[model samples]
Structures are given as structure tokens and as C-alpha cells.
Target: MTAPTTSRAARAALVLALLVTGLSMRTAVTSVGAVLDDLQDDLHASGGAAGLITTMPVLCFAAFGAATPRLARALGPHRLLVVALAVTTVGLATRPFAGGVALFVVVSTAALAGSAVSNVLMPSLVKLHFPDRIGTMTALYTTALAVGVTAAAGLTVPIGEAGDGWRQGLAAWAVVSAVAVVPWLPTVAADRRARATTLAGPVAPTGPDAAGSAAPPARAVPMSALLRSRTAWALTVFFGTQSMQAYITFGWFARFLTDHGIESGTAGAMLAVLTALSIPVSLVVPRIPARHHRAVVGLFVVCLATAYVLMAAAPRPTAWIWVVLAGVGGGSFPLLLTLLGMRARTADTIATLSAFVQAIGYLIAGTGPLLFGALYGVTGSWALPIAVLFTALGVMTVASRRSTTPRFVDDELAASPR
Candidate 1:
């Protein structure tokens, strides 16, 4: 069947919705990392609990990602996006009012669940709506995500200094999601109408196939199908390891610096630079020739390795350099996200792969912060924790070698049962 056609205006509006959604969702999650100390102090949270605060969104992302494909199938992707956005809005708006850690967890979990679905759906949306501009649009959306992260991480302290409660600082991001919905209203209506028509079709009794034998029942693509594909497993490992590194940095890098004798504000600024630098790096790296992409991947790994070495060896004057290296390596994130679209054979395959990869991938990824923190608690120094990061990067290097190859689509197709 030919894909459904949407007008240019509608497409533009949908893209806008995606960009704004990306920005809002990222801001909500990253802002707390920027002000972790303040939030911990204000709420009287322990280090372990503060760690959970950061990990909560990632856990929700993994949990909710599994449900997105089924939800999209039932509600239609467009309408599901509307509901997700609304949930995100409510989640963000309520953060300031939560009475304690339990309430904070509830609100934050809901918001991140919404954001998680949105993240998984975004690639398919790009494929459906802007097939011709996947690379460009991926770059844009990823850039918006980077900018949002940087803004939230960088500005939270300043905003709090300006007498806005950190709660208010964090809650303010909901307005972005609310604004993003404006451009989506018409598309949501159209999707609801289309779904209504689909449901109203003449009913045929469910029975055997045309051959007169019982029709082979449609089963979910087996989870093992993904496990058996070397490429899929490689991508999963790549995503999981890199994501672990990213979240480790997001959740603990500021505190790590502060512990190393940097002031909290300086640490936050360094984190902002690390995130902001990813915008240009993400945009530029994808445009390079595919044959040479592995070299870029190697460069990122080297940068990460060097940054970890410096962070462990020289903690003060060289901290900024380490942050820059981390930022450059962070570009791999958007690269992986873009590849999810580029590497899939069909929209159905992309949806399936997206759900599987993000769900399993993030569950693995979500452990980094807790593990690193626990290691610190035991070792009583950052050195061993930094060593663990280096090990993860080494694993990422091996996984990325396969991932950077321009053949996952072909590999997945060849591996699929005929």
C-alpha cells in the first residue's frame, strides 16, 4: 500500500512538533542533573536517593519504550503522540508541587515515560513524514535535544540564583511541550478521523487463509529474532554501552568535578559545554563519507579514553579539556539514533527494532549511574569509577566498529526469514 500523503504545511507542523518535543523532553530530564546538589540539599535526599532521581527517567524510558509500538498500533501514532505530549505536560507541571521523594518519583516517572515513547516514535515519524530529509532532520532534532540539555544544565543554577525555586526552574520546561502541541492539533484530528474510518470497515469473519488451511497466525516478531541478528545485537551493545557512559556523565559528572575541588557552578558550566558541543559535532559527523566514518568513530573513542585518563590523572586545570573530549565523544549518541532509521529495512522493522533496542538497551544503560556510584561508595575514590568508564568505552569501540558500517539494513534483510 502506498503511504498516506500529508500536505507540506502539515508536514512542517509535524516537524515543528517533533523539534519542540525533543527540546522539552530533554530539558526536563537534564535540568535536575544541573542542580543536583541544590535539589539534594533542599529535599534532604541522600546520595543514593539523588542517584535514583537521575536514574528514574532512564528507567521509565526503558519501561515505557516497550509499550509504544503496541500503543501506536492501537491508538494510531499521531493520536498517541498527542496523549504522550499531554502526559509530559502534566508531569512537568506537577513536579514543583510534589510533597516528597515518593511524589517526586511519581511525577518524574510519568514525564519520562511520555518522553520515552516520544523518543522511540520520532525515528518512524521522520521516516513516514520526511523520508527524503532523514539525515538533515535527524541532525536538527538531535541538535535541538543537545541545546535543550545544555540550556537546562547550564541555566538551572543561574535560574535558582535568581530566586526561582529549583522546582520552578525545572517545572518551567512544561511550557515548551505545551507550545509544541499547538502545531500538532490539526494532525491529531486528522489521525483520529483516519483511525475511525479504518475501524468502520466491513467486518469479515476471522478464519483460515485463501489456501483453505488455517492461516498462519500473526505473532510478534520474536525477541530472539533480535538476539540472533549479529547486527542487531551489535547495535544493542553499542547503544547500551554508549548510553551508560552518557548517563554516567549526566548524573555524576558535576558531582565528580565538585569532589575534585571545582566549585559546583564551574562543574555545571563544564557540563553545559560538554552537552552544547555535541550539537555541532552531531551535525557535522553524519555528513562525512560513509567509508571514512569508522575513522571518526575511532576518533571519538580515543577522545573518550583520553578524557577519562585526564579526568583521573589531572582533576583541576585539565577538567575543561576532559569535558570537551567527553562532549566530542557524546556525538555518538545522535549518530546512533540516526542510524536506527538509516539501518532499518521498513517502517514496521524500524518500529520493532526501535522498541526492542530502546527497551532492552536502556534497561542496560540505566545501570551505569547506580553502578558508578556504588563503586565510588566502596572504593572511596573516583579513580576506580573512571576506570570502569574506560572499560565501557572500550566495549563501545568494538560494538561501534560494526555499527558504523553502512550495511545494517542489508544485513537485517538478509537475515530475516523469507
Candidate 2:
């Protein structure tokens, strides 16, 4: 789809709309952790069942992300975004009404399916509208994402305590989800008009420059072909591995800190700190030149690896130190988001790559926390899980280096079928 033209005022409005949307993306996933114990008590959910609240983000992200590009193809990006937000609002609002584990899981899965679409397509939106401000806009929305996680994690428990309890906490985020859908209505109208205005000229029957040829440049590439790119594989490895480690940390770190003698309130706050500290890094990292991402991201990965080592060895007295280290490392989140936009030259390529990276990448990520918890169940220690996290971080470092190599994903797609 062609980029929509806008005046400065309209562009700023669109940016604000995006900021609001970004705030809703992680709320459904991160808020669950704060009230997980309470839900287990109230709903009588097993540890495994309660855990689905956290795991659903990665799973729905993979599942929903796999379908987002086609929706975006059939409906333009702006309209698909509006559609996703409306569905998210429903999912978020309906989830709090569940009286049992099964219903809650179903609603949350629905909510997160919408979440998945937003997460995968957001980078393409930034590239489509703010191509000149890739770093700035990427950093902005990503910081909004970081803020969303911090708010949901840090506030959910307190909100639950103040009112009717866990249900209130679960329903609080739906407000934001509903509000974020408003600014895009105008843009959706613009997209429809643009689509209708495109001329469908007849094909020039048989020449070097034929009619079907003109439309080929604007058509969607076969995603099957994209999976064959070595660069695409490397990007998936990078995105998936880091996300795997993050899912584990987001899902379990609060409880891990509490087990080390930290108070439950303090423990939840530490997880918030880990996500909160990433905000500045997310805002700044994407603005820097791509030439520097290798060293910058590698350094962050090393810091993240160090946090795992510390958590494994001595998580008690130095709890604050290690968690901060983890947050600093988390700043690479924007770097990853930047690559989604920066690696593609056109909007279509950006959307396709975003879908592939989030779809395949998140499916790989969904196994992380599940297996980390499973390994702990089997080994009766955090050693193996921590070691596994460190290994994932190492693989991520290598993938980050390659995905940031200043290459276009489309170029790789054009090179061959395989």
C-alpha cells in the first residue's frame, strides 16, 4: 500500500495514536504476573494454568502474527490496526468476567491474538509514516511499550488490593485498549479512499513492459521464499532467543526475588525496575546510527548475561544490582524493533519481515519460559535454567550482530528461492 500523505498536524496526531496503541500491546501479558498468585487462589488454577497468562503473549504473538500480514494486505495497515485494537478491547474487557480457568484462558488468548497483530505490524507503521524519523519514532513507540509493561507489572497488585481484587486489576487495561482505537478512525477512512482511487488499468498484452508487470512491484512477496534467507534465519534467531529469555524473566523474576527474602511488594517492584530501566535505552538506541548497533547491542547482551550469572550465584543481597543489569540489557528491545524497520527499503518488505520475525520468532520464544520452569522442576535448581538463559543470550548476541549488518531483507529475498 502507498503511504498516506499528511500535514504536520495530522502526522503528530497519528504519532500520538501510535503511542497510545503501544501502551496497550504489553499490558495484557505483563499485568498477569502481578496477580498470578491471587488468581491461583481465587480461581483454583494450577501452577501450569496460571502460567498460561504469561505464556499467552508469546504464543498469541506467534499465532496471531502469522496471520497479520495477510490481514494488512487485504486491509491496509491503518485499517488493520484499528481492527486489531477493537478486538483487543473486547478481549481485554471480556477476560475479567471469567469464572473459571478455561474461560479466562480463552478470553486472554483472544485478547493476545489482537496483541500479536499490533506487536508484529507496529514497526512497519513507523517506517510507513515516519521513514525519516525511523530512530526517533521507533524509540518513541518502544518506550511506550516499556512504559506499558512497567505500569501493568508495578500497578496491578496495588490496584487489586485497593478494590474488588484481581478482576479489577485484569480489567483496568481495557480502558487503554479502548482509548487507543480512537485516533486511527480518521486514518482508516483515508486508507479506504486511497484504495478506491487506484486505477485498475488493463494489462498491456505482450511486451517487455507488460500490464501485470506494473502490479508485480506492489504485490506481496511469497513469505515461503523469505524463510530461506540466511539473514532472515539469523534475525529470527536473534529476536526469538532474546524474547525467550525475556519471557522467562518477566514471568518468574518477581517470585524469584521474593524467594530470596525480599518482600512481595519489593519483589514486584524490582521486576518493574528491570522493565522501567529499559525506557531510556529504548528511546535513545534506535536514534543512533545502525553502524554502531553491533557493539552497542553486544554490550547490552553481555550485561544481560551477567545478570543471569548473578541471579544464579547470589540473588539475595545484590538483588537490586542484578535486576538493574537486566534492565540495561533489556534496552536492546528497541534495537530489535529498529531492525524491523531499518532492514527493509519499502513498506511491504517491512511488514513481511516484521510478521516473519515475530511469527516464527515468538513461536520459538514460547518454549522458553515453559522449558525453563520444566527444567527447574526436573533439576531442582536454578543452575540449568540460568545456564540455558545465558546460552540463549549468547546466541542472541551473534544473531544481533548479523541482523544489524546493514543489509536489506528484500535483497536477500530476491537473490534466490531457497
Candidate 3:
């Protein structure tokens, strides 16, 4: 039997749900970075501990990404998202009330995990629900995510100054998550009804040429197969290295600027600009076809390289030019995510690739901030660390070129016929 088709109304509802979900998940991670200094002073925390607050959310992305497929398999994607949102609410609510370092860590980690699962599952949702509009919707959702991160990062300082304390400032983002749930609830309900009516009996087994096949055998495309693919490795490495660079800027660029004699507020505003400027690029780039992927990737690398050189060598006025260049270069993120969706042969394949790529990739990426910090601590200068970033970007250039080709999923499917 054919599966039930979604109505236009259902499709619209899914789009809205995804937008809000993306916004809320980003706010959870970005808000704390904006108010880090206030939180540190208020809680009497050390620099390393404050850094952990920022790092925790990213680490959670890798840690919890591995579980998203299992959760989706058991609960269905819509229901799993609701659970993730609920967990996010609990995590945000408890953060303000945490009495000590231990409690803060626990609550923060919980929040991060929720955000992580949402991040991993969202691309698949986009692929499943809006395959025709993948380019457009991917652009929109990614732009929303960039906007959310920028707003939270820019507003956290002002919000903390407005009232209660840093705790309240950090906790305020729960409201966004709560509002996101309104549209999602109906989607979840509809999904449950759909599942109950459709899957009333055991699934049929497929020998060959079975259109009803639920999924392929695990052995068909083992982890070893993915590991052996150069394209897959290049994609993974490209994603990992760019992510590391992004986090390094996100987590420490403000501090780096402040240490170099810029005022704290100015540094923070610049950081906000860096994140905010990417929104337009992210919204526009994914709508274009794969033919221009290599050119775009090469342009991003050049922008990043130019940004690093100016940042290290130039004086004040020209420095911000490089900053803007760096922001525009970071547009590669949405491009990569869109490529991931377009590269997968099936939903199950997307899930497996996402888990493997993100889990190992993010863990490798997670070391950037710590390594940058350690390098600075030892050398007592930004020059060497900036060089390190340039080197990473160089590697990113080559890896991105390999990933820009559009033939991986096709090759895999052709190799392993049904």
C-alpha cells in the first residue's frame, strides 16, 4: 500500500514547526556565550569553568547526536522532537535555580543534550517533509538559526543588565522553546494517528525488488564502507575543521579582542556582527544548485584566509574588513548541511551518515577552543594561534573541494542495488 500523503496544511505546519525548533535550539546554545562574563563574576567562576559553559553545549551536540536515530526509530521524529523540546524546557528552567557548580553543570548539560538531538534530527525532517523545497527551506531554517544565535548573543548582555541577574538572563530563552511547542503539538498528534492506522501489522520481508522494503540490511553498507569512501572522509574532515574554526571564534574571539586592548563591549558587538552577517548568505546560498558548489567553497576559503591575515597583521580600521570577510566565509555551513541532505540515498542512510559524521567530527572539532587557549597560554601571543587557524582553513579548502562533487549517494545506490 502507498503511504498517506500530507496535506498542504500539514506541510505548512511542519515548516512552521521546524522554523521555531531551529530558533529555540540555537538560542539555548548562544545565549550563555553572550552573558559569560556576568555569569562568571556572579558565580565566582574561573575562566576555564566559564569556557566549559560554552563548550558544554557543543560537546553535547556530538554526544547526543548518536542517539537521535534510535530516538526517531522508537518515538517517531515528531514525537522525539516534542520530547527534546520538553527536555530543553526543563533544562532552561532549572538553570537559574542551580545552587552550585555541580548543579549548573548538570542542568547545562541537559539543555545542551536537548539542543544537540534537535540539531541532528532537524535536517532529516527537512529532507522528509520538504524534499522539493529542500534548497529554499534549508536556507530559511539555517537563516533562522543564524538569527537566533545572533540575537541571543547580542541581547544577553543587555538582558542581564535589565533585571534580576545573569541567571534570569540565561533562563529567559526557555520562553522561545515553550512558544515553539504550540505548533509542534498538533504535528505530533497527527503523526501518532498516521502511524497507528498505517502500521497495524508486521512488516513484509523483501527478497529483491521489494518496493515495500522498510530498510536495507545493515551489512549492505557497513561503517567500513563509509570509512573507505574518500568522499565521505573529505566531507567529514571539511565539516569538522570548519566547525572547529567557527567555535574558536564563537568561544574566544571576544576574549582575544579584549586581550588585545579592545573594550569588552566593542569586542562582543563585533562578535555579534560576525555571526549576524552570515544570515543573509546562509539564506541565499543553499537555493543555488550543486554546479556552483566548488566555486562557492573556494570563495569561502579565500575569504577566510584573507580574514585571518588581516586580523593578524593589520591595524584597527582594516581589521573589521577581515572580520566581515570571515563572517561571509562562514556561509559554508548551510552549504555543507544542504549537501549532506542531498547526498543521502534514503532516510536511513541520512541517519547513519549524520550519526557517524557528527559524532566523530564534532569530537574532533570540540578540541579547537581548548587547543587555541592552551597555545595562547603557553606562547602568550595570538600570532601562533592565528597561524593555526589559517592552517586549518587550508586543510578545509582541499577537503571542501572534494566534498563539492555531487556523486557520492548515486554511486552508493548504484553499487548496492535493491
Clashes of each: 0, 0, 0
User: Which residue runs of candidate 2 sit more than 4 Å off their true CA positions?
Assistant: 196-216, 258-263
RMSD per candidate (Å) reads 6.5, 5.4, 4.9
Quote model 1's TM-score. 0.86
Model 2 lDDT, full chain set: 0.79
Candidate 2 local Cα displacement, residue 257, angstroms: 3.3
**Residue 370, candidate 2: alpha-carbon lDDT:** 79
- Decreasing TM-score order of the candidates: 2, 3, 1
What C-alpha lDDT do the candidate models reach, one value each? 0.74, 0.79, 0.74
Better structure of 1 and 2 per TM-score = 2
Residue 115 error for model 2, in Å?
A: 0.9
The CA lDDT at 93 in model 2 is: 83
Worst 10 residues of 3 by lDDT: 198-207
Clashing pairs in 1: none
Query: Positional deviation of 76 in candidate 3, in angstroms?
Result: 1.3
